[model samples]
Target chain A: MDRNRRVSVEEVKHIAELAHIKLTEEEETLFTEQFNRILDYFSKISEVNTEGVPLTYHVLDLINVYREDEVQESLGEEEPLKNAPKREDRFFKAPRIV
Target chain B: MKTGGIEEKRALSKLYELTAIEISEKIRNQEISTEEYLYSILERIGQVEKKVHAFVTVVDEKALEKAREIDRKVRKGEKLGCLAGVAVAVKDNICTRNIRTTCSSRMLENFVPPYDATVIERLKAADAIILGKTNMDEFAMGTTTETSYFGTTHNPWDLRKVPGGSSGGSAAAVISEEATVALGSDTGGSIRCPASYCSNVGLKPTYGLVSRYGLISYANSLEQIGPLTRTVRDCALLLSVISGHDDRDSTSVNLAQKDYLSFLQDDIKKLKIGLPKEFFEEGVEEDAKGPVFEAADKFEDLGASCHEVSLPMMSYALAAYYIIAMSEASSNLARYDGLRYGYREENDEGDFDTVFSRNRRIGFGAEVRRRIILGTYALSAGYFEQYYMKALKIRTLIRRDFERVFKNVDVIIGPTMPVLPFDIGERIDDPLKLYMCDILTVPANLTGYPAISVPCGFRNGLPVGLQIIGKPFEEGTLLRVAYTFERNTDYHKYRPSL
Candidate 1:
């Protein structure tokens, strides 16, 4: 475990920003300490000699599976938009980005 | 000449005590109506739900309607499915059509899916009555069910202690006889952990063996929906109903299905069971270890051979598992941005990023936010190679380690959890310390091997689980071994006095 690798408040804020989450001042301070400890525990992976090992993204022995390009009856627009917190007609309403 | 009230209560308790298989037989033979069976379970739930807090929502009306339909079909002499008339509770993380599947989080508190999960469809096809949704850790994140927004599910054996989670409610439901069987998803020991703490049987099927089509993804690559039941035979029956190919889930294998119940022979003669030394070393409590070793001796007495094996790379499995799971969770949980389904902040009339951030901040709990933040950091540009990639490489090594060990031994056996059920709120604040409890169970999830947690013994009135890991898609072997141990021991027979 490397002490130099401890996460800082700035890093925690940046990570939260990237994760689309807003943290309060108290939460930011709390996460800074918790992240450092958890990351320090994760640092143990560096000890393993994985020099020639390939990264396993998935455990199954499957490749890209292609389904037939057939039009099928799926959920209607109303069904999906039913749970939207704010929906205008059939489309989900969101804050303007531009 | 006992009191009528006491006699009636005893009869009802006896009815609730019958195994799912026996109840199904009685239903099929017209000795008991499916409606009566369901009423008995619902009655018991009404009795203990306040103490246990096992269910997030109980679909009383819908369950009765379905039970009546099954009973009507039974009276007509029509064919019934394998699980006909059985009461099955599903973890809230798995989607249910027209039923609110809240994943124990406020984020999806009012969100109802328009579709059922593949396993739910299978259970419906088997005529299994869906009792209701069980509580869980919010987004299946915590080891104990305390993180649930609904409330913590108490361990049936001792209400003060936690039933291990994130499938805590499902395991508690079974142990308390609220439901005959349950479906729980295990990202890293969610099912087995609760099963251990509750003294029930849970199986995490080999990845891709069971379809994950409708399971709300906590970690897409690491989690698999599994069964939790009071008996190994019921576990196998539930597995048979749910296991198979689904084109909807691309990762699901198109393997031939077998009647898992047929593998329940009491004979493990000439079987090769490996006792991994890393699992039983220091950190494992003596109370938890004693029963597991005794179980190994029991296997040896049953004419099976037990050997001490080593999966040295297992020491790094916890690190690798959390890194991978949290990274995946950060990505999977990014969909709850207030625009689509889930909780939303209506008054946020700011920029898109502000709305998204605010929605998530208010929607997610502390643990979920922590994992999402850490995961984003792990995958960040400068840190990807150092954290995320390193964890994946270690995952490869862990997989290879299991592959190498499986060639010599048919199965690896060890304690499911390193400690007995801790008092609720003991480690809730210390997230890192809480993660340590999963050390022994995460290796199977990392390697995509099938594993099961069966009650082996008790410690100071709390239960200990023995975990058996088998080769990929070799759940038959795992169930066979579990069945043997369960038959030879009376550990699973001890029910909570609640």
Candidate 2:
């Protein structure tokens, strides 16, 4: 592996475009340097031996935190709709749904 | 709006050292009027919140009314609930009836829940005054408050730096005395990380110990609501009020809890505390290690035994945390269609593809959109095993590492973060670096163990936190150790002069 391999300015711009963050040209230059340094810090992790390890997704030993099957009164329809920024009667309004 | 500023700050200041339990005793004995305590803190919120930006909403009318009702009960010689008159802040992610629950995301910038969260209902029954909803990361996705559509929350200790986030605003509020305490949701160190940076105590209870029904999901399996406070005893008090079996959250544990304050008095005489070798490393700032070791030394002086333990899988904790968190996030956030709740933008330019893409492109922030896309790609049929499944396996190894250590030790101690709070814009440019910020606290989240970040000492004039990891449902032991440490050091009492 080429340890000195570096991503170019254009490549950083391409990633910024992909991420949809409207970055300035200067931001592209800054991020390219920062991203490389971050990858260097992160490369340290791959050196660890993770063989035969089971991936743990959640730590809580709880299998199920089920509540009794019962319905409670909703806070009423008007209360929620009242706070909507753009609502037309019972429903919230949006620009276009087509 | 004129809340007797000077008188209120002084009275509320007196109750700052008192736990919700102790405050209730004072309220019962008529040492302080309920209105006097409530308004005093509300006045302080008014005085400091403009600069701290700790609260997103302040329900002054509702809080004042609740105080008057409590006063009426007292005059009638009626009994009050355990947390009566204690002022608390809720993270904007937690639902509250008649209050906007934005989750700090523009997608739901104007969304309001139709009901109260289970914990909110309990707090109300106990007569706890709901000051307002505090700020958080947009959709609880980022580490810094910068990701919020509203704005970034500055660290109270040092305004230019971030309060480690997505719960940054809540932690900042408690540190600045904007509110006595606040509730924050943790998924992979959101609570503990920020609590450490802001010099407050933040607890991420074992995943199912607290209900997640009202908390907007970030990573469903990893999220837990916990308290962030200025002291360990207050954190214990907050936990006592929030922990219980909740039918609303399918995964909430029904474990019995004793009065957590009782644990503070218990002896630490023969308890074994583990210090993981992987935690103390070259990447960690040299200054942070001193306080961590100093805290360990204090524990030894308190008659507890400390040992070095190995958690080899911890090196991958941050990577695993991101993969799993993003994968779950991609799935969890899919519900926020332009149809159900929140903002909607029209795409008149093209066909179905343009329309769908445009909606998300405009609605979500750069970080939120990045995680969603990454998660969606990772969980795609072809990549699940390579990314998501493999991450889960690493997670299990991490948990097993903790279980193995816990077999011999009552608690595990370490630095909350590798470095202290960084400047606001420092890591935002590199997503990977931002994710790396949670390295020290992620293992506890992966394994479902309860961990807390307590104000232990200072470095370069800023506070440093000591993190303690406890076995499941052993919050009592965690509190006792933290309280004992706080008693030994004046770290918790050192409020920022700002």
DockQ of each: 0.86, 0.27
With candidate 1 superimposed using the best TM-score fit, by how many Å does residue B366's alpha carbon deviate from the native? 0.4
Compared with the true structure, model 1 gives a TM-score of: 0.98
The prediction achieving the highest TM-score against the true structure is: 1
Per-residue alpha-carbon lDDT of candidate 2 for residues B1-498, written as tens digits (9 for 90 to 100):
234577765656555445566667788877877777776677677667777787778888888898888878888989898888887889999998878898888888878788889889878887898888888888888888889888988888888898889899899988887777899999988999899999999999987888888888889888899999887878888888889887778787777755787788646889899999888986888777789999898899989999999997888888777778888988887766555566656444554334445555567887887677566655766657766787787777777788788999999999998898889899887787788788888887888889999988888878888999999888999999888888888888788876
Error of 1 at A98 (Å): 2.2
| lDDT of all predictions | 0.92, 0.79
Candidates' chain A TM-scores: 0.89, 0.59
User: What DockQ would candidate 2 receive versus the native complex?
Assistant: 0.27
> On a 0 to 100 scale, what is the lDDT of residue B312 in model 1?
86
Interface RMSD of 1: 0.9
lDDT tens per residue, model 1, B37-154: 7778988999999999999999989999999999889878899999998999999999999999999998999999999999999999999999999999999999999999988999
Candidate 1 lDDT for residue B285: 92
